[model samples]
Target: MTGTQPFVLAEQALLGALLLEPSRIDSVRPHLRPHHMYRPAHAALYRALLDRPPDPGLTMADRTMALVRDAGAHAAGITPVYAHTLMAACPRPRHALVYARMIVEAADHRLVREHAVRLGQVAAADHARDGLADTLTHHRHLHRVLDDLHRRRPDHDTATSTPAVPTPELNPEPPLPGNLDDEQALIGALILDPAPMSALSRWLTPADFADTAHATLYRCVHALVLRGEPVDSLTLAWEAQHQGAFAAGDGGLTPELVAHIATSGMPADVDYRARRVLRAYVLRTAASAAAAVGTHAGDPTLSTSRLVTAARTALTPLDDALARRHNAITATKAPFTHTPPTTTATPWCTGVATWPTTGPDPTNPTAAHGPRSGRRP
Candidate 1:
């Protein structure tokens, strides 16, 4: 099947830009993978761009010829002149990164569309067999596949040069819906009264907040609480600025936002709001764990024991969090009491010794000594 035409154009433009200016390859290479290009020739050319060594002496034409020869474009009936054709077609060489992202997005869309068609066929077959449960499972699997494809991005470092492609057995985690309202309310409550920060810190983390701005604000407040500093609007704005949290643009935290949250009608019951946030987080975590277990359940390579262990590992954090909450409630209800010392003192040191009130005699050190000190012992 033919790939999307716009993506093909984008792929050509990116490759063309790289060929025209190899110096910009390092910046664009991290975001673009060979598989991101839909056409085989384009993918091969991108691979060659990544694989080629830095050679300042080589002219652009020589480099283009080398890339074409090394990529085996001759087999695809491509030539060195095609590189110049692409360069001439490209509108702006400086927008290579933008074109690279467009390619990735287009590739993702195509993958999702293809998978959806396949999933529809499977669902139809399963429905004919009267396997409703199996059909639902396949639907969930398809959703996870699409979700992984959308969320996965290249890492900053080249620990793994290749991006992980989603498969039936080794699918990435499904995206869960976070309660943004609860997250914002909890953060606002904290800004209103920093006292709840101590309790919230035990059960919540910045990761629990769905909004990036809220997470940044929570992190700042948590740090201030740890350092015994005030967590008012001004301090939070300062901390956010210092941490570069507000530089993200658009939805980033701002001083006015901080002040508004602080002055808003925050929940009088801060603990209740905190628990709501924690509940949302726990539910989201449980759903993710269940999805992960379901995805790996059918893998033949994973032993039954390994699958069980994986499920346990995924669910253990939620279990531990609930256990801690229960323990905290139990402790709060119990009375406080001072316990006596458990250890006994030695008999030889039970009695106290008297000391002389006078200062030590410098003229005779022995004169200041006690009766048992100077003569015999």
Candidate 2:
């Protein structure tokens, strides 16, 4: 016996009930479809049952034999021996609806799991291509399937205590081999020219970096740019030191390495390189979300509603990244720079020019101009 044997028995019982009382097929038909059968042979038998209804003139034994013979035309391996086994398994044919409901619940669980597996496959493919559009399309399809399952679920569906979902047998396949290299390149490009940080910052975050050290350095660069401070190797190294990026235990980033990273990439490609890093983050997050959905779907103990809810929760991170990407793409321009409150002169300003509190007013030409000289506005 295997983990699936219980469902197999349930399938057998449902079939047995319908076999004993062919009239009950009408009652079960609304709730149980042929595809709901876990075994292909059983599904073939179901279709046979529907197609070769007992001739009113035939004896029950004759009808059973005829249906069993007919099912062989649709699927291989159907035999009279199994037909006898199914008939003997029926406890009471009158309760056929109950058995049908049982079969439907188990079948729905299997369907949900199969759908999750497909979604995971799509996400894995997207990861291979370093893209998210196809993954998002499949993600949406999975949700639609889940929603339809929720509506189809019998009202009596009771919540079972969710059994623990087994973790992936192996750690998620290590991230794409090129992810760290892309992170390094994006960081290097941004350090070489901070101008693109204005747009990149709107959608990209330090946490998106796949490498811990790269993330730290990106954060340093992001901060310097946000403050309107000049971003150079020296300024970044100083910020990194204060952030403890070069602590003894941390070996990935050193002062000399920071200088190298600052000059390692072409500044002109900063925006394009930054998008690559962001794409990697999205792909990784989508793959993780797909895995979580699969895990939840596999837990037979979870009700359809619970499974759907769990899947949505697992997908939240990917959804967030998608939303950010949409915002970045749709915005006409980056929002105005927001400098933190400081009593001292603005770090990037030459003298006592105070940063403006609001964005430029299109109607006021002067609103776009800062203090003209070394005087406060």
Best candidate (score: TM-score): 2
Q: Residue-wise lDDT of candidate 2 within 1-377, one digit each (tens)? A: 35656667777877888777788888777778889888999999999887775567988788888888889988986888898898887778887787777677777777767776777787788778776778778777877887787777744434464543344432443567688778888887776655556556667777677777788887777665554455678788987886778984354789998888877865556656666777777777777777777777777766666666677777777788878767766643555443332325322222323343343332233432333232223
Across residues 1-377, which tens digit of lDDT does each residue of candidate 1 receive?
46547667888888888888888898887777888778888888888889996589998878888998977752474577787887886778899998988787666555544544454455444434423344345445655654464356432323254233232333322222335666777777777666556545655666555567777888777665544445567777877776677786425678888888767737566665566555554444444444454554434333323333444455454456555555545544565332211122223212222222232331232332223232211
* Clash count, one per candidate: 0, 0
Off by over 4 Å in 1: 1-178, 248-251, 265-267, 327-377
lDDT of 2: 0.70
- For candidate 1, the clash count comes to 0
Residue pairs of candidate 1 with colliding backbone atoms: none
Superposed on all Cα atoms, the candidates' RMSDs to the truth, in angstroms, are 22.4, 6.6
For model 2 the local lDDT of residue 259 reads: 87
* lDDT minimum window of 10 residues, candidate 1: 340-349
Error of 2 at 280 (Å): 1.7
